[model samples]
Target: MGKGPMGGGGPHGMMGGGQKAKNFKGTMKKLLVYLKPYSISIFAVILFAIGSAAFSIVGPKILGEATTTIFEGLVGKVTGSGVGIDFTYVSKILIFLLGLYIVSAAFSFVQSFVMSGVSQKVSYRLRKQISEKINLMPLKYFDTKTHGEVLSRVTNDVDMMSQSLNQIMTQFITSVTTLIGVLIMMISISGVMTVATILMLPLSAVLISFVVKRSQKFFKTQQEFLGHVNGQVEEIYGGHNIVKAFNGEEDAIREFNKLNDQLYNSAWKSQFLSGMMMPIMTFIGNLGYVMVSILGGYLAIKGSITVGDIQSFIQYVRSFNQPIAQTAQIANLVQSTMAAAERVFEFLDEEEEDQFAENPVKINNPMAGVVGREFQEESNKKSHHHKEAEREVAVVNEDEIIEIEGSVQFENVHFGYSEDKIIINDFTANVKPGQKVAIVGPTGAGKTTMIKLLMRFYDVNSGAILIDGHNIQDFNRHDLRSIFGMVLQDTWLFNGSIKENIRYGRLNATDEEVIAAAKAANVHHFVKTLPDGYNMILNEEASNVSAGQKQLLTIARAILADPKILILDEATSSVDTRTEVLIQKAMDNLMKGRTSFVIAHRLSTIRDADLILVMKDGDIVEQGTHTDLLAAGGFYSNLYNSQFEDSHEEAV
Candidate 1:
């Protein structure tokens, strides 16, 4: 089966929406820790925001003075008793009002610039932490989650938090400051009119609460369905070939339509409800304006307020309703920010792999003994064969390093992917240094699990794995893994040049060494035929090359690593018969002085193996040399005979 974008699982395998923060208050408190480092920047943002609001708030009142000056001058002109229209005084008020607005704009610009920087810095730090956390997290943590899910925490969630933070921080401060400042200014102008504006607030509040409450669920459902739609698209596209091969296009389209329909319904309802808020509030605000206008005209007639005061009160009324609307929107934004923060923090808080052992045993040049010397001689012979580029073998000081003969012992091992299902039971094996042991088994016989356990990818439940009489756990995980090189059925190559991909096995390997390793794996000839040769770039999926070539490249990588223990899991499965023969020869040369564990489905390839382990249902039923096992006429005989019988039937 072809793997989907999310490792073969469909949309239902992904995290569903409505995943709001369980403890929003607590998550916000934790998010404050990230903000703590930028407290000064945030404080500056708040101050600037307040300054912007304060300056802008005073503008209308100052403009009111200019209006009052013009009004008095016009009255004096009509009465013919005083100078008409004091142009000088009005000009001064107009200039002062312009200055106030300029200062307000300046404050707003500074705050926006500072807050943007702070938000990006926080995002950068969180992404960096999550990237580092991924390396420290246990493999088990990843096994349960899809790749898209983990990536969403890094990309989608972080972006959401950052964008929301950037907008909300300045918006919240400015809204509150404007609300309070405008209220005070309104009261100064006319308490009676201010009270009239204030009375409309209850109606505004009731309307806002109603819209927000009704729309919130639809918004959440929209978000959920949106995720589902995205997941379906990603999965379908990623495995489009398989879908077509099986004629599943109609089914795929049907599923997509189902999700898309839900998305449409939720999205429109949410948008319609949210869109109604402003218009509804505007109607109520207009009613308040009518009331305030009548009150202000009465006060003006009775000499209780100036025309300028009435103008200022009206401006304040518009300002007042805005903050109330923004406050409701900010509440929703805060919820989203907290939810994003919670996911990011949750990923950061995942259980990490125990990387370092207490008083860790350090193994140095484990192949520095007799096996190392023989391997060096063999490598020298292979280097001589590569006339274009000579191999550069690392020479280590034997005196400073302890020799690990690559002898492995699995003592009464028991393990499962989970605690409830024991797939490997009472497994025991002993492998001496430089032995070529082949494990042959039916599918689901725990062949791969044994290798994983040997490498400490997953520790055995009740027994210990030992290398040279030392428990594997005693060694640091990095140091322990360094002893082995693996080439599996599924070959992995990243998007890089062929040379870089091979050099990944040994980062410090020289160009000459890489070429030599490629030649040793029988990859140099085929690589030379390709465009750009070793410099050819692999695409993201590495699909530019054939499957067998990819497998060969991986083998070349392992050869370059020159590990003390070699693991070959259906390593030559992708290659043709002739290419397999060539690869098998190269593998024989590579395995000469290293302890090798070869898991093979084709039994013919391993007839010369020093030990053939026959496993069925998680238990090794037979283990001996091929000749010995065949002579026993037991489980190995039946398995060996059955394979040949199938081949003969196909041949006939």
Candidate 2:
């Protein structure tokens, strides 16, 4: 709460022992923008805020009158100035002030409750939008930022903004209102007393400004340092085994200590500044007290003012200073929360991909000199079915089938993650419907990159990708992604029943359909042997399931979806020889009547592929049928020889 456990001071990325805080007005302004949608809730909070503030103004005045009445009653009874003592007036005023506090308390509760509910709902909407945006963002975005840092923007930063809404708006309005009301009372009571009382204003203001500036800097630094530490912790958690294997315990601890120290120093500065606020103010308050006593006392004795007037002036001075001092303490919390707001707003501002496909490429539309007599007789029926099939697989459309041709073509494509690095250079490929293609390569050879491009994960820099005779880019993104079922090297499984895991492929699929798909993938037997069969509760990421089992489950899930274009990346890489053989058989049957792309490490799977692209350094050096490429005496020949035919070590 006080800049957390670690301390660093100054605006984000500041270095050294101390740094000055920036003005908080700009940060606060940016934060208020998120509240625009909840204007009604904001207005409600303001109305209550004003109610509480007015109650506060009335409270002290009532209490002061009660005190004056009691003093007059005690002194008047002794003198017997033809007046008897009466306690009823003082007690009634005290009761009225007490009632004001009770009502103010109720308003405070309502303001906090309503504002928090509205803020949380907005947080949910913003997070959902951000999640959808990232889902469609090009892979380049994540490459430049860690998953943890991105998560922080969603979870931690958004929460910080939400948590501060009540404190920021409600308290700020109440304090400001109280300050104005108190000043109005002071100026009316006595002109000379009011002027004299305000003389201490300049000194108190300087102390507050200095402390607020210092605290804000420290708090901002604290937020940045905490984010850095969170990112580091996430990385270590992901690679804990690898770290321990490499003897990185000491290194990890040292890195943590460095982050710890920055947190420590920043927190120290913020609290030190916050701590000084009260004392410096108290010292200034004491000076005002002494000055008012001497001046006020002389005026009272000279009959220039009454004793009650002097007492009330002293009371008014205390009321004004107390709020200013209290508000100064939460300044650090306000600034730290505001810094987090900036990071969250950055994510909320990211652009989303195109969603509409009102006029996609027609089956009749074709590139110059590309369409031929071979497609003439049945092209219309084929295109109609293709679009309908695509619509069916789209997640958003449970009942309608999206139309898209299964045929795909990359035409002289050039692309890269950034200006400095070109990943795909002049790449071109053609996949007729229902062709089984295999892409093999060494690490960093753009094998996966090709698959991503086919899925429209990124747009080509120069050329176009076409499905059937139409450019794929012209199609709706939902329709485009729905047609392909992808199973990556790393598997992700949600926490749910075994049946639910398979049903994730197509949410509308029946339980019987899921079981049938599992049987096709040879995973049904394993599920039956489990304690609860389809209803068994799966652990997070499916840890209870073996790695091979996890792979099989996901594949079965994909089979249920029955995507026209199947992407199996190292589908058998994790299983043993026997299981791999079983899986390979299941995979062969699965690929028989549908277009498939396979990336496998074992040499046997791709031997009969319609096309095998051997890639290295982001370029395809050889492409053809297995028999044809081997006969060509090129890069493919050399690769097959080393990988398969130790017997035939032929010189190129």
TM-score to native of every candidate shown: 0.90, 0.83
lDDT (10s digit) by residue, model 2, range 1-652:
1222233333221221232225456555655655677889889988887787777676655665666666677678788863654677767777887899999888878887887787787677667656655764666777777666687677766765666555667667777777888788777666777788788889888877877666666766776777677667867877999999999989998998899799788778776766676678889988888888888888877877666666777877887787675465345456556666656655655554444345643322121112222222223233310023322222233234234447778788887877578888888888889998888877788988888788877777778888775777876555566667887778888999989999988777788899999999899998899989999999875889888888888888888877778888876766788888767776776776778888856656789898887887878778888898889988767766676565445533
- Against the true structure, candidate 2 has what lDDT? 0.71
Clashing pairs in 1: none
Each prediction's whole-model lDDT (CA): 0.82, 0.71
Error of 1 at 504 (Å): 0.9
Clash number for every model? 0, 17
Candidate 2 worst ten-residue window by lDDT? 364-373
- Best model number under lDDT: 1
RMSD of each: 8.7, 7.9
